[model samples]
Target: MLLAIDLQSETPIYTQISEAVIEGIAKGQLQKGEALPSVRTLAVDLGVNLHTVNKAYQLLKQGGYVQINRKQGVIIEPNAFPIADEAFKQRLWDRLKPAVAEGVCRGVKREEMMILLDEIYRDLNKM
Candidate 1:
């Protein structure tokens, strides 16, 4: 997977790594059952710490986006994708509310935000 990390950004490196993998999956660049680089390998490739990559992988595993195996290493979830349950919905809301609030505070209109969201959704789904 290709992860674009901005070291200077305020966002944490591990968060950026996990987000990139999630985006890759959404964009169909990473497929189900596909193996990801090992923690050490990815750390070397990205010139980040091994712990950073491992933290990202752990987050993905917790989110049900990937699975780690001793023999197989790390691979995309091979079975069903995670269902959008109530817990997920609440989590989504919690994560998005702050961003939406920031946009609102910046005087971004509802329509404008919707348009931007639609564009991003379409772009991610374009395979």
Candidate 2:
């Protein structure tokens, strides 16, 4: 997985890392069964403490996005993706709600958003 952490972000480092990986998964930038870099490698790449990468891996594990193993390091555990936790779901909507509202303000219909979602789903599946 390719990642760039923003030390300048108001969000936590783990969160920055998690979101990038999750979005990469959703967008099919990282495919099922692809190996991600080890946490230490990622920390070195991002110029952050190794603990930050470990924390981010823990979050990804909690979110059911990746599997952390002693031998394989952090790897993408493909198939059977689960629904995100309720709070995370709410947080996602909180982020989307405003964008949708803005789209509505710009006269984009709700069906358009649904169609867009479908398109992205189709595209990702094609990957």
Candidate 3:
């Protein structure tokens, strides 16, 4: 999977890296057990600090999205992926609340928001 990061984005570099990897998994571009570039390699390739890539990898490992092995380096979790548990649901809801609130503030109708959401969901799945 190719990762593109915006240096100027308000989001932190590590967050962007982690999110891109997550999105790749969601899109089935990064299969289970697939190995990712080494942290140092990715950092050099992306012109970022090694710590940034390591931080992203650490987050992924903590989330059960990847495994780090001395021999294997980093790979997507081979045995299983995380299910959307209550905690995950709560996190998702928390993250989405702002966008929903923004829509509300802008007087966007429910149908309009739903339609927009549908379009984005479909677009991501199409990749």
Candidate 4:
């Protein structure tokens, strides 16, 4: 899995990790049944605490992205895809709300926001 971590980003590390894994799946870069790096390995590689990686992995497991086993390690679900959860929804909203508000503060009209949103949505759908 390829991830770009920004410690200074407004988003937290765990959230960024979870979102990156999910988006990798969405972008067809991460396939179902693929094995993920061990938490310890990833922590060492990323120079982060083991607990951070564990927390991220736990979030992925809770979202049904991957399954963990004592001996088998972590395996991406056979059909890891869309996950609908209130927490995920709220996280998305919290991230977007700030950007949207910034645009609004800059005098972006509602109709313009709708247009921009549609264009962005279409661009993402193309992926």
Q: What TM-score does each of the candidates earn? A: 0.97, 0.70, 0.93, 0.75
Instruction: For residues 1-127, write the lDDT of model 1, one tens digit per residue.
Output: 6778999999999999999999999999999999999999999999999999999999999999999999999999999789999999999999989999999999999999999989999999998
Q: Residue 24 of candidate 2: its Cα lDDT?
A: 88
Predicted structure with the largest lDDT when compared to the true one: 1
Go through the candidates in order and give each one's C-alpha lDDT.
Answer: 0.96, 0.84, 0.94, 0.83
Candidate 1 least-lDDT 10 residues? 1-10
> Which pairs clash in model 3?
none
Query: Please, what are the lDDT tens digits per residue for candidate 2 over residues 73-98?
Result: 77787676786779879988999898
What would the per-residue lDDT of candidate 4 be over residues 31-75, giving only the tens digit for each residue?
788888999898887788888889999999987898988788988
Error of 1 at 2 (Å): 1.8
What's model 1's TM-score? 0.97
**In TM-score terms, which candidate is top?**
1
CA shift at 19, candidate 1, in angstroms? 0.4
The superposed Cα distance between candidate 4 and the true structure at residue 42, in angstroms, equals: 0.8
The superposed Cα distance between candidate 4 and the true structure at residue 70, in angstroms, equals 1.9
Clashing pairs in 4: none
